[model samples]
Target: MARNILPLHKRDKTDTPSTRNASTIVPSEQAPSPSHEPKHHHQPHRPRHENALHSYVNNFWRNEIVAAAAEFAGTFMFLFFAFGGTQVANTAALFSDRATAGQENSGLTQAPNTSVLLYISLIFGFSLMVNVWVFFRVSGGLFNPAVTLGLLLIGAIKPIRACFCFFSQMFAGMAAAGIVSAILPGPLNVSTNLGTGVTPTMGVFLEMFLTSLLVFTIFMLAAEKHKATFLAPIGIGLALFVAEMVGVFFTGGSLNPARSFGPCVVTRNFPGYHYVYWFGPLMGTLLAFGMYRIVKIVEYQTVNPGQDFDDHEAAAFKPPKDAETAEQVGRPNVAALAVEEAVEEAVRIVSRGSREERDEEERIDGRLERGEQPRYVSERELLGRTGHGRV
Candidate 1:
């Protein structure tokens, strides 16, 4: 479906530098209240454009910290579920075989091959869903470095903040995987084999392709802002599941480099698969960015649909001269105007009310007092009684 992209509006145009820079600050003007006027002020302060920019950049960094922390927590949780599931699956397979041998006379065997695949995929999928649910509202639910990098490429994220998110995700992934390894039972055969999910060279390429596809899906879903944001994570998880099912035989489906690196580091079995872990996922991230750019050009005519670069730049500068003086502004105070009109109308209505109207009001009041259903009042009458004019 074609998506609606919200246009970016600038709050201040003065602070923005002619040359675009990542660190530039943008300041927003506070609208003067109805009770205050520019002429009533004793003195007007000159705009401190540089100071405003400094504050803006500082606030941006503060928000970046919060975003990076969320990314860390989400990535950690994802890796914990993923690696923990792998451990449990491997152990189950081993015990299942042992049980089959014990019941040899029964001539029945439960291979657990399908079960393992299903469980692993589900673990990854569920992790993604939960993390995204928890963090989407806060940090856009970017739990992977590749996803963050793709956002940067499309200018959805500032370069500095994007770098922080990427590193945070990588470290968090590594830490979570290491922790899972420490708590699990000694090396299963899978762990001994470096826990590499697929064959080497082919696995790398597959990881690149699958990761790119996953990221591309995220961009498409995210562009549709009217839809629930939670769908991005669900879509991403399902994409991962499908890829796992198709690629598990060939490459173990390590679409995320950090996911691969974490287990390998803790197991102390890098085994030259490091090339795939890093290069493969990096290639995938770049490919995803490129694919998203192509799709964006074809679908939306812009690289990113919901971003507010113009607003960000405006926030860093001073207001323009043609802007109305704070005193001469004629915008009505909605709340105050509504209240005043309501009061005036209500007084007038009460002064003109008949005995019948009074009795009806009393009856309604009685019904409310007795917890019975009250008679519905007409909109005109209700508005008049509430001190608002006719609807």
Candidate 2:
């Protein structure tokens, strides 16, 4: 048992990074340290590649799936209520007992009743607003394929994400249509069809123009990311509402291919002008894309004229293409300009004070010259009451 014990050199506990660099841990179960600094814990450091992989998986794969699922559910919700309301609107008119043999088929074709048209328009608009408000945080509540395409073109979302969302919305549309068809006793009259006196050419153009308005609004309001972005659902819903009001009598206002495709599939009756919906939205997407790109390249905010922009207000906007806008905007010497303004204001105040002082002096001199009692000062030879070398 004659083992020699080596001297134990105690290590210094102070050999560690400062609290600024060290990790802070506060456990609720344990009492805090008396020293007003955070207690450090021994935790393993993760590799950069692991962090990179985690980010990629979460953002690229996991988020894409979650977004797609959200889009599916959101689309189903939007189209379900929309299709159900249409069914009600279309089916309710059929109960009219005043119909004769000479009268038109209201079920197969939308009736020209002003009340019904307004009802359908409001139903679609309000449904969109409500559902978008619900799912916007999840998948942006993009219930339309045209919206996904527009976002893709504007680089708001990746192409892969757009594809997933597009497919999800399409299938969801079909599901909504199929469910509505099953639950409702009447025909699935929600299909997009040309109205009276509407030609194929006219229908295509109508859809194109209508969809353009919608995509443009989304680009400006939602995708652009401004102080008013939270109000995007309202604006977007109203855009659809107005478009429906205007075009409901023309081409059934099929601004979305999913909306068109689902009804066609459920009824197994595709109109010859069915291509109109697809082509029109695609063309409109291109239009919105072109406008968005042009505005971005030209620095659209450059046209802001006579605006007294504050910190909370948006003084400028950038296109997704020019997101990294290297071009400097406004005066770079902001502090200097502020200082100059303050100096000018101070000068004005000083000048005003001097002018008032001069005027008071003039008034005092006038009273002195008049040799009046000058009631406010001593009445007996009151030259000393003034500052003009009075004695």
Candidate 3:
């Protein structure tokens, strides 16, 4: 320190020229460059390329969530017309009621109007058809929980997505019923009930058969994924139409638990046999799935496939293209994929092999390279015994 402050002439003997060299900074001890200095500017809390909020939203609204939203909206619209028409049917039935004037002016009961029942059938069928046609591309227009389960069983939809759709359908069913009750003026009769003389046992089996018919149509039309897939809604709607026509009279024709659930929620009524709606539909889903599998095993399309229009992949009745890869258009073959991978691995192995391996690849003329020769050329030798004059 004294050497730095002192005049050269006044410096101590220890601070001489050679010793003073130690007082100055060496290159190794120099201060850090400007870049190495601590930065004072604030850095971003999130990455620049991806926004945290956007990533969160994308994950929150995944495919399952989007499908669930579509299910909720579609189911709501489906049941809105359904419940509204049911109320109208009940009201219309009142006008259709005919009372016979008894001799002593006695109170009389009237049977339900058959015409009103048909009207209910049309309302449910047309509502399903229109909404399914509108929303099938988005979320499969599966307003019914049983249909969703059918798709899940057949491997058309994932488990998470099925769960999301189930909850969405249930909530939408209740909402539709609530709205109908609030606006319409009539006691709700949409809830399922066993008809007069109809036992609980009969109701369950009947409900199962009706629901099975609906699910079977869905599997063959939609899940099978054929040229007629676009027209699946028509068949599905009609299946519900007939099922409802029959079951509506006996079991309220509740082919769907959601259909049964909504009215119960609105009217605040649960029949002691409410279990029929859920259990019957579930059993029906299983039955339809089993039948579809049986047909699949037997290759029914090959046996009695009706018209062999052999339609094109997209449009029903359109002829298929004359291409070898036509059959593989939508179907993924694992064996084909394995062969592709095997070819790639062979190419990679050859690419890294010795020069000899490269020459061994398939050739057009079936000829060896110029300088290469067969390890043993028997015929070309001409039995040298004769050539040596030993014959």
Candidate 4:
């Protein structure tokens, strides 16, 4: 080792970039001190492509265009399944050999017509359930324009976004109807007024009443936070199923305007009062709004009995058990408790003083009635006369 040692001046410099640059650098007139050396900030290890992709994704998702596109896609998927089911049922019934009408067979009148209704109901309900489950997080599962309107009226969705949702739903309905019409036979493509038999006026009322109940159910079970929120889709589907069962004959149970709109447009057969579908659902939304308000009021009263009835404050009320547990875990509302304590103390002080004054006045009145001289003495005088203030 001693034989191999070399002087620092004769040693070869490393060929690294920094060493080469240092060697080639022209010496400055004045060299900066070590303290003045530039501190290099090292960025954390990250792929450039990853950062680019992340920014693109973040901006894309937040864009309104993407939201509207999502709405369109969800609505299209929903209507495709809903109307496709309808056409399938209708086609099957048309080709069936069994007597759809109530006819006397085997010495008994056998009506297979009810089977069609049942089939349609189940299909529609299933379609709704699946679509809602699939698209709930992205588009709020609003496959119906009326539902979008309801959300708008309830302040759940903004007006512009609601408009986009409405347009998407209607367009999807129309597209689904057209596709169904094209795929099925000519005779099968013809719409059946959604199977409604009632007059226009009766149909409007039926739709309004039924849709009101449906929207009411949605508001109560799905929109509000509760145990049933997880089962909202099922509850909504059942509500529609029940409404269909009740109003299927009277108004075709077309609670959704989009459901009716598609068939009407494809067939070009506007049942005399085409506006009924729109008017009915919108009116039903208003009724639902009223019902939701009443429900919120009742819920508020039930949850917070002693609190003021304020709509904005209703949401803050928790379940009984949760509230009690929260009260135990956290400090109570100190300001309100302090105010109550002050009020109670004031009342107690005033009452005690008033009672003592009444007793002294009563004693004086009794003495006067007995023909004895009554005296109203100051505290200092009484203390001096009694020698001790206790008496």
Most TM-score-accurate candidate: 2
Off by over 4 Å in 4: 1-63, 97-112, 186-197, 300-391
Arrange candidates by lDDT, highest first: which order? 2, 3, 4, 1
Regarding lDDT, does 1 or 3 come out ahead? 3
Worst 10 residues of 4 by lDDT: 102-111
Clashing pairs in 2: none
For each candidate in turn, give its C-alpha RMSD to the true structure in angstroms. 21.6, 13.8, 16.0, 16.4
The segments of candidate 3 whose C-alpha lies over 4 angstroms from its true place after superposition are 1-54, 59-61, 98-112, 305-391
Candidate 1 segments exceeding 4 Å error: 1-57, 98-112, 188-199, 300-391
Query: Candidate 2 — which residues are off by over 4 angstroms?
Result: 1-59, 97-109, 305-391
Please, what is the TM-score per model?
0.56, 0.65, 0.63, 0.61
Query: How does model 4 score by TM-score?
Result: 0.61
Q: Please give the RMSD of candidate 2 to the true structure.
A: 13.8
What is the per-residue lDDT of model 4 for residues 1-391, given as tens digits with 9 covering 90 to 100?
Answer: 1332553322323459996577567476454555765466444588555544465567544544555667677767766776666556655655573355321111111223677667667767777777787777776788887788888778888888888888877887788778766776543232334232457777677788888888887787777755357788888888877776666545556788887777777766676677777788888888889888876655443444424324533443333653433233232344676689799999999999989866765675566568666354663354455353333
Number of colliding residue pairs in model 3 = 1
Better of 1 and 2 by lDDT: 2
Error of 3 at 79 (Å): 0.7
Per-residue error for 48 in candidate 1, Å, reads 21
Order of candidates by TM-score, top first? 2, 3, 4, 1
Please tell me which model should have the higher TM-score, number 3 or number 4. 3
